[model samples]
Target: MLRRLVLTAAASVAALSAAPVAAHADTAADLGARAGDRLTVTVTDAGEGQDGTFDLECRPTGGSHPDPAGACATLDQVPWGKDPFAPVAPDAMCTMQYGGPATAHITGTWHGRHVDASFKRTDGCEISRWDSLVPVLPTTAGA
Candidate 1:
C-alpha cells in the first residue's frame, strides 16, 4: 500500500510538471529591448499640391525626422494596444472649419510592432492630433 501511494504521488507530480506554463510578454521590456527600426513618413498638402516624405529610425532617434528626439518622446508616452494605433476620443469635440489640406501618412515598425497611421487637420480634434505629432509630421500647418 505504501509503494502504491508513492507511485500515485509521483504520477501526480509528473502530470503537474507536464502542464504547459503560459508565458506573457512584458510590453515595456519588449519595447525597450528592440533595436531602433525604420519608419517611413509622408505628408501631403493639397493646397500646395505637394507631398513630403521622410524616413525615420526612432528609439535611439535617427534618420531625416526634423526632431527625432521629440517625436520619439511623444510616441513613447502612448500606451501600447493590441491595435498598433490607439483610437482618437469619440467624445472629443472638433471645429467645423477645415484646417487645410494637411495630411500625413506614417508606416513602419514601432516597439517591434507594425504601425500604419494617417493624420489630417480636418477639424479641431484632428488638428490637435496632427499638431501633437509635430516634427513627426512636418511643421507647415499654416501652409
Candidate 2:
C-alpha cells in the first residue's frame, strides 16, 4: 500500500511538471491606450556600453491607422553600463525611473506584443513600465 501511494504521488508530480505553461500577448487597442503613458522598460543588452534606441511606429491595420489621435512616444538615446533591476513606475508621458536608491519590482504590459524590460538591482529584480506612444497616424473611427 505504501509503495502504491508513493507511486501515485510521483505520477501526479510528474504530470504537473509536464503540463505546458500558457502565455498571453497584448493587442493593438491596448497599445493605443498606452500612448503617452510613461514607462521604464529595458531596451536591449548588447553587453557593451549602454546605448540603444526605442522606435515607435504605427502601421495601418485593417486598411487604416490604429490610433489616429495619440502620437507614439519616441524614446531614443538610452545609455547604460549595467542593468537597472528596479520597478520604475509608469505614467502617461515618459519612462522615468526614481533615483539610484531604487527598489525592485516585476511589472509588464500586454500590447500587440508583450514588450517588457526588467533589471537586476542589488536589492532585487525590477521591471520597467510600458512606454507611452503617441500614434503619428491613427485609425478612423468607422474604418
Candidate 3:
C-alpha cells in the first residue's frame, strides 16, 4: 500500500539523519583521546621570580608549568558552558584602583578549540580575571 511505502521512506530519512549525529559524536571522542589538550602561557611584570613562559598539559597533566596539577585542577573546576579565558564584558563597571603592572598571554587549544586570550591587572575586572586562574597566572595578591 502507498501508506506503508510512505512510512518506510520516513523511517529511512530519520535513521539517515541520526547516523550523522552519531558519527560526529564518535569523531569528537576520538579526537579528544588522541589530541588531548595543551597550552602555552607567558607572563611578564608579575614580580621578582614570577615572569616566564610555561607549558601546561591536561588530561594526564604534565608540562613545564610550576603547578601543572593545580592549574589543571583550577581549569577543570570552571563551570560547564562558561569560558574561563573570556574577556570582561565591556558594559560592566569596574573599580578604578590599580592592581599591579602584570600582564599575561595564554595561547593553545582547550576543549578542542583554539584559544589565544590575554590577561592584565589594571583594574577590578581585569584583576579579578587574572586572579581566577590562580597558579596558571601567578598570584598578584597584595602586589
Top lDDT: which candidate number? 3
lDDT of each: 0.71, 0.32, 0.90
| Cα distance off (Å), candidate 3, residue 23 | 5.8
Question: What value does the lDDT take at residue 99 in candidate 3?
Answer: 88
- lDDT by residue (tens digit), candidate 1, 1-143: 99999999999998787664321246555656557666898888834533677788875678877667877777766665544344467897777767787787889887777778888877877777777766577666463
What would the TM-score be for candidate 2 when compared with the true structure? Answer: 0.19
List model 3 lDDT by residue over 7-85, tens digit each. 9999999999999999999898867853578999999989887899999999889999999999999998999889999
Better of 1 and 3 by lDDT: 3
Question: What residue runs in model 3 are displaced by over 4 Å at the alpha carbon?
Answer: 1-17, 20-35, 141-143
Q: Is candidate 1 or candidate 2 better by lDDT?
A: 1
The lDDT-based order of candidates, best leading, equals: 3, 1, 2
Compute each candidate's TM-score over C-alphas: 0.66, 0.19, 0.83
TM-score of 3: 0.83
Tens digit of lDDT per residue, candidate 2, span 1-143?
A: 99999999999998777654321223445556444333332223322332233333333221122332243222222233322222444533432433132221222332323434443322211212222221221111211
